[model samples]
Target: MPSDVRRTTLLTVAVLVWTLAGCRTVNRGLTEAVLDGEHARQWHIRYGSQSFYSLGDEGLAKIEFEGLIDRERVRVRYQRGMQGQAECVADVTTRLIEQVELRVGMTITTSTTIDLLRFDEPPQNFDIQLTVEPNEFPLPLFVRAGDESCTSILAQNRSYPYVLMHELVETSLAARAGGRVLPDVGYGWFGLGGSVNNYTRWFRDGLANYAGYLACEILSDEMDCPECPTRVAPLLHTSPLSRLATVRTRLFSWSQSSPSEHEREHYNAALGLFLLIEDRFGQQTIRDILADVATRETVDGRDLRAIASQVIGTDVKQFVADFEFPMIGGVLTPVTRALAANKGLNVAEGLLLEFVEPDGPADRAGLRPDDVIVAAASAPVADTIDFELALLRAGRPASIPLAIWRKDAGTIDVEFPLLYPGKD
Candidate 1:
């Protein structure tokens, strides 16, 4: 639903705005006074869109930033209205310097709280005032909670053992960064413009991160966030990892969706690996390692087997051989074994098997037992766990495409009209 909002491309108007803004040197100087080094080098930059919502209300989307940050308490205020406009305000505290560069802009340091608002509002209503300097703009600075710089550190209070802020910050960052679809092997860097978009995969990764955060909280006593899935699952009372595996398998077996068991398994396996690395190294190591692997090939760039050998300094074949993926039906299958025998799969574990309902569309299309469905349409269906889940999540009947490995015919593509199971 969020993705459905069409982005308008007003080429002529945008071009005219840019051209007109560039033509007036005096206006440019005045505008630069705000964005340049004046006013303690603070700015309130905003971008957003206006759209009609289903309720006939104007929906507004926006983001805003302002001020130099000197303290840790970064306060941002956001208000949404039924009309096609929103307001955002921020209070930031930062050290002042004569000159500083943040990304593409040159800025000055001034300790201050900048109050800024954006809409189709008049400038006089929101114009901020400050003491003028003889040669340059003097920056206004404010400090909250007793600190003069308008960015004072909160007094330490150890009354409670729970550090919710820390957890929230960590999880928020993790979720923001997690939504990446990863390559099973080869160089780790996400490739762009090769008929595949890395950001799209990253979006999926964000979901996985959310799952991980929930898993961590629910299974904290037995297994922490950084523990390997192998080690963590064994520790949990309900075995969170096991449950995830089960859910993934079941989702795969469902009637609709994308992402095969192989793909899901690969994702879970990477998660498991991250936990393992965290357990062996440290909790912080997971992100660092992932970032490294994501930007470049592993040191060896061979395969997981090779990398595992280097990291654990042991023969990984036995461990790989022993690996099994769990199914919601309480079955365990040796994914690694199937993979080792060249099953033409991506992930070795966490596959699902979904049988078409009797007399249903898949059945009418000739799908049979042991069909080894790989994916539906464009969705990846590596195994039964995630497949089943995907199917149940599909809200309507849709055409399904599958990659099946028949014992007699090998791998082949099949299309079937898939209706909602209950409805069919």
Candidate 2:
């Protein structure tokens, strides 16, 4: 065949193969191959490259990248197709290190690599999963994507920055302490074996949330006008003290509540406690606690309490006791009973409003603290459980009649609209 004819024939065959690949799963593999190479090379140059291999156990291949921040080489790795995201994460992380160091006035000598993963679809059972390699020198930090569609932009903005800062702070503490800092017990009762002994999930979570709040403040200020209000959102719907007061009963045992409740009540309670500590003792107290923990060879609930007491120059027991029981007489009791009795309100068969989130549907409907909820959607509201069930049964954004009894005012009826916070 002539040279031109031969060239034309080869081009036709290539186009046919490309067209066929476009219509099948094979196209994904081809595209991923191209992306993988491009991303690996880019990260390898931008952040120092370590190795390229399949994350054998994880069933994913990853490229490792490293960069220097304050004499520490921060490493980051990501699976294919998330190179840009990883780069953004790395940049944010570098800034976090500086912020943490400035706030704590401690150098983070420990080395760590942040691993990023993206999912095509949300996992059926899990949201995001973050793990830290406690024993490794250059600690391996794993960050996996959650259901992005389900997460609000506000939440993402708040949480992602917080997670980065929280991990860095924890890792920094671990580096100084010479090992992994055990999880917090939060509000676990004293005697439960596995239940009480397990690390307090809320402590770290609250700490992370606080860190996220701080990061938001920093970023917002950095990006905003000089006189603009702080960009960080409130950590909880109500005041920390109120949150702690309301959830006192549920704190004793993790098994008593669902995961969602744990996230809301316990985590917020923990954040509230930290906020209280910050309010009473100033920011240096937090630094002191972290520094003290770093020096300690081992840490436990008692150790943490002792550190808090030492730093604050007050009995940590009083704080715990206060959180567990906020009554004036030092009696440990549920907020419902305490409020009904103290306020001289009849509460034989009604859910007392311990809190009414500002601007929430309940608040918008004129609900207030100490108000007794008699009925919702014509159903008797005997307790919180009943109220919750009624709300669920009422479904989303339903305007239903609510019967409330006020001490000064007579029995009042109002239409309450049930709504989700971030949904509407």
Candidate with top lDDT is 2
C-alpha positional error of residue 160 in candidate 2 after TM-score superposition, expressed in Å: 1.5
Model 2 agreement with the true structure over 232-252: per-residue lDDT tens digits = 222332234445556653443
* Count of clashing residue pairs in every prediction: 68, 5
Any runs in candidate 1 off by more than 4 Å, and if so which?
1-58, 61-75, 80-240, 243-269, 276-309, 315-320, 324-424
Q: Give residue 116's lDDT in candidate 2 (0 to 100).
A: 52
Clashes of 1: 68
lDDT by residue (tens digit), candidate 1, 293-359: 3443222223323444454555444433333322222222334445536655444343323454566
Q: TM-score per candidate, in order?
A: 0.25, 0.45
Measured with C-alpha atoms, the lDDT of residue 62 in candidate 2 is 33
Q: What is the C-alpha lDDT of each candidate?
A: 0.33, 0.53
How close is each model in CA RMSD to the real structure?
Answer: 24.4, 19.9
lDDT of 1: 0.33
